[model samples]
Target: MSYTPLVDAEGFAAFPAPAKLNLFLHIVGRRADGYHLLESIFQLVDAHDTVWLRVRDDGQIVHHNPMPNVPAETDLTVRAAKLLQTATGVSYGVDIRVDKRLPMGGGMGGGSSDAATVLLALNRLWHVNWQRQALMDLGLQLGADVPFFIFGRNALVEGIGEIMTPIETEATDFVVLHPPVHVPTPAIFGDPELTRNTPSLKVSLLEGTADWRVLRNDLESVAVRKYPQIAQHIQWLSQYAPARMTGSGSCVFAAFVAKDVEKNTSQNQANAVIFGLPKEMSGFVTSSLQEHQLLGFASD
Candidate 1:
């Protein structure tokens, strides 16, 4: 789909902000500063939300739709634009039109990815050319998940998603089932019985492990306890591949070991089912992305 470009002195710039999955999240402990320490493998997916933007003369940030449930002022897209405007000292403003295809609060990093796209797109559109570290710093202020999107790869994230280390894996495809329901992330994290002390594993060990069955999301049980639909989806997807909850999920995904084999050989595979939300809810199956793609409004 094409977007109508907002007028700007320097024209427009666009970026494709992709969603991500936490292959496994282990919350180790809470620090004295109250930040939760975590370890997870973050893999970006090809499915994405497109954000279109152009510089505005008055330095005002505007978002289309403004997300009914989330406050306009508190939305990450607005905060991200404001942060970039302040950091770059660019007198220019931005008009951002977000095509939000990714399900909100699905543990898919939709909002955070959008925020990261804004930062990255604005840096180029505004001619800021700030270093990657600077962009990451700007992204972190927006949200914990934002920085990892900036890195734009499969990553081993730690320390509330600030710390990033690259990881490589065999090509894999995922079928993610999203329930129409919204699962509040904070509520799951705040659960008293939530596991917060999974022993950390080395990056080398993770690389050597072929069977992902050994890795797990420590928060999955707590999430299942909070939302039974999550548990149900997990059960359904597990029949196809080793499926588990992603982040604090209302969305769960399974990785196929052999895409070709599964597509042709798995005759008994059941039809995919999405629970909680209506059968009409939109969902997707996409492969992992090597790098994030940038999109925007273009004069045609």
Candidate 2:
């Protein structure tokens, strides 16, 4: 079923911040600024962390429930609201409460997505009325993946996550396994043995001629070397389908393509896989999202 935002009787609007899976990540090059140039198809999924927002007239952004160890000032949702208020000089603030569901450091883009949702939801809540691209530009300042969530569609992302081109992806279900480990992104990217010379396939991807199944994440090898549990999860899931690590590390997924005659075929396959998972492993079944739930919150 499609997702939607909801408002409670107390006037708190709950906005869904959906997670994302990197179908295939390639490190094509690195810039002089030490930022790695990447090419990946970012697929939106149904797994979400809800951000409940209520406008405040006092012009003070407050986070009612911050994630453990993450201060409210550092929390992406709070930061996003503050950023918007500062950028637009809107004499308004918000109370933020995030129902954190996605795993931390699992490469699921949870924090980034929450930040994006705040930016989208508050644009209207505060009547900022900034165009979507402007908000996307603002989102880039928050996190690389934040802009893509604001972009709000399955996209061929490139250029350190700023460039995005919408791409058509078939509906599919994925069983995402989050290994119990927090991968430090810098360590993985700093590994000397990490591959950084994958050829760019931007042309093929845009032309719709690329065979994505054969493509792979270049960072997987580095991440697996540092965290063997990730490799173990990938190995276990691969037995069911062609499994791979998404984004940096920790979370791995195997896709189940949908069938025409059986509408529930993919979900069933995912459910069975999750049901049979080893007790030590943890994961959930989620389908591809055609667009972000707040895609219409901002105008193009």
Please give the clash total of every predicted structure, in order. 5, 0
Prediction 1 TM-score vs. true = 0.84
For candidate 2, write residues 1-117 as lDDT tens digits: 233568898889899999999999999999999999999999999999999999999999989988788888998898898889889999998988889999989999999999999
State every prediction's TM-score relative to the real structure.
0.84, 0.97
The RMSD of every model to the true structure, in order and in angstroms, is: 5.2, 1.5
lDDT values of the candidates? 0.75, 0.92
Worst 10 residues of 1 by lDDT: 265-274
Q: Which lDDT tens digits does candidate 1 get at residues 1-300?
A: 333334446454556789998888889888887667898888888778877786788978877668778777788888998888887799998887778898888999999999998887787778787777778877888888888787766877888878888777556667788866678878878888988887777555456653445689888898888788778777766766788888888888877544465454221132233333246444566667765664221111
Native-to-model Cα distance after best TM-score fit, residue 116 in candidate 1, in Å: 0.4
Query: What's the lDDT of the predicted structure labeled candidate 1?
Result: 0.75
